[model samples]
Target chain A: MSNKTITIDDIEVPFEEGQTIMDAALAAEIYIPHLCHKPGLSPHGSCKLCTVDVDGRAVSACTLPAAEGQRIDNNTPALNEVRKTITQMLFIEGNHLCPSCEKSGDCTLQAMAYHLGMLDGHFPQFYPQRELDASHPTLVLDRDRCILCELCVRASREYDGKDVFAISGRNTNRQLIVNSATGRLADSDIETDDMAAHICPVGAILIKDHGYEIPIGRRTFDLHSVAESDLGEIKLSNVRHHDE
Target chain B: MSKLRVGTTSLAGCFGCHMSFLDMDERIVGLLEHIEFTRSPINDIKHCEPCDIGLIEGGLCNADNVHVLQEFRENCKILIAVGACAINGGVPAMRNHFTLKQCLEEAFIDGIGVDNPHIPNDVEIPLLLSKVHPIHEVVKVDYYLPGCPPPADAFVKILTDLLEGREPSLPNEMLHYD
Candidate 1:
């Protein structure tokens, strides 16, 4: 543990010598909204929800290490507006019909939208025809709900050692693909207990027959706002799964 | 002060949003003191006359929806899209993934419970649009209140703000999309 402190949004928080701004902020019980960042997994910085102002320049907090006396702006109207736009883009890129979604309350994407006060998609729907892969006996993969955060890809490779998932293609054609002979999850070696199965931050990867097990009003985000939840601790446990 | 005129409608949706508006409960009695309904399903008005604000509660799925929405935009000084359906096509736009013909045939000719099924071609029926569209896709929406139907509190807050001549900005707790 280090005794050094860095200022974030004018609040002083101690940081280890090599801790990133996001890591330090989390250590101090502060949350910088993020989707692609899971502690202990290598930082992807893909979502940019954790982007913050440091020394008057916007930087991704997950990858930007905090230095002594560093001043970071984690929450601002403009930064939140940017995050909302990103969240909106993610919603439109997929057919995120939140009302009918099984992950309506538990999904981090939905939680972040609520945290940022997002009221609409604010963008045109791409209406991309994505497939729902129910080939697996225990899991359902609905590409329509995927935000391509790569949490599953990282979890499968780093934790489960299965290397079962990887993102493929480029730009709008980008999609999550199963590493199997038939490109079906059932054909893969992933089991119901795999970390990849539970690591998805969206409704894209779901364990069959497990949906709505916790009713909508009783789910995580329903009981507490994302900011109110112990999201840092949640990510810490997700990363801790790698050790077990 | 002149009473603010409000008009509302639901299209291509479940009318759950209008129900949420009604969820304002006793507050509706208070709201009536400052506002008047002109062309809402709540009052069963056939057409919109000039109004101060128009609240639309669904997406566009047919020509009639578009016609009514456009009329709202033209007749009202401000138009608000009041739910997920009106904001981003909500559940109705789920059909955007399939071809219009596929949806029609599945509902008419090939559905499991359909009896002597055929696509309706009656001149009296409004033709279904090729795709469902949010209110903004057809006409400009001046404001949006997102939610499956934004919380009853959201309706009260926004309406109260507008009635008092302030721009409506929902507090985070009042703004939800589920």
Candidate 2:
């Protein structure tokens, strides 16, 4: 580890140098609210939900590279206000449908709402009409409930190289698309093992084979908030566990 | 002119795959050394012409989206489905449970519709694509990559191998998504 330390809000933090801000924060036991942010996945600031005050400007901790002497304050009042705005934007942008959402207690947005104390949307709702494609043997789409976080799309495009998923339209009207023009999930080239389905934070998309099968408590949504869960114990164990 | 011109296009995907290409960092300049990027986000070309490789990101969900896919097929000698969305219908395939009418009505004309107009029964408006599909279904794809977009290293390995006209030796059985 390089002898370099970065400061976040008067707190001097040390990292291995080149470690992402989110990674460093998580290592130092600081919580950064995120949905698409995963250890195995590349950090893209698409969600805009992880924005924290760094030198008085809102920057995503996941993407913003770490530098020396950078002051970070993720728990400030100003940070909460920013988070609230982002949560409201996500809430009104799509039909979140929290009451019926499978990812209720364990969702990134729900936890962010709790963290920022956001109750309702301040912006007017833009209920874009999307479809529910469940023809695939594995995944299902509840487009109405999508938050346009682009996690799935990124997982497919950047991580998978299939780019089998995409965001159609512009701005608030954007929506998820599968394959090329075929539009049928069965017809698309997506495989059962693709990480795209696992990346969706909301019910807008789900792995059909796994739904209603985990009995209630075993699903990730039922477990805990991403912030509380941290780096993800399951992934760690699966990686270099003694059993392996 | 180089025999292997290339065009990279994004359909309904997040731009992450393209970013991943950039994630290759300075290695890209070496890639740029050989092939040509005809139509890309970096380039402003709208329609794609014939090329050596068509690197497609995102899946298809709309009528116009299909047209673009067809264009890439017409233009590229070797078309590749570059992400999960193009591989197994990805996450967007989840929405096929509902009909096109329902999706459109819910998005625009339904009681919940917002700024979009309810173009009810207009011939001018393009009809919805039948279903969300993986790239191979709509058109024959020469190769399929099955990551969300696939790790950047995976991409680098595949592209370098492809450029050499040899089978890419990146993922083995364990790496296959299954």
Q: Write the per-residue lDDT of candidate 1 for residues A108-186, one digit (tens) a residue.
A: 8998998887877777878788878999988999998888889899988887888999999999989999999999999
Q: Candidate 1 — which residues are off by over 4 angstroms?
A: A230-235, A238-244
Per-prediction TM-score, chain B alone? 0.98, 0.82
Which window of ten consecutive residues has the lowest lDDT sum in model 1 chain A? A235-244
Model 1 DockQ vs. reference: 0.72
lDDT of each: 0.87, 0.68
State in Å the error of residue A78, model 1. Answer: 2.1
Best by DockQ: 1
Q: A126-240, model 2: which lDDT tens digit per residue?
A: 5446667888877678887787778777778766678777778987567787875678787787876666756666667665544444443444434554556654532422221
**Model 2 alpha-carbon miss at residue A185, Å:** 1.7
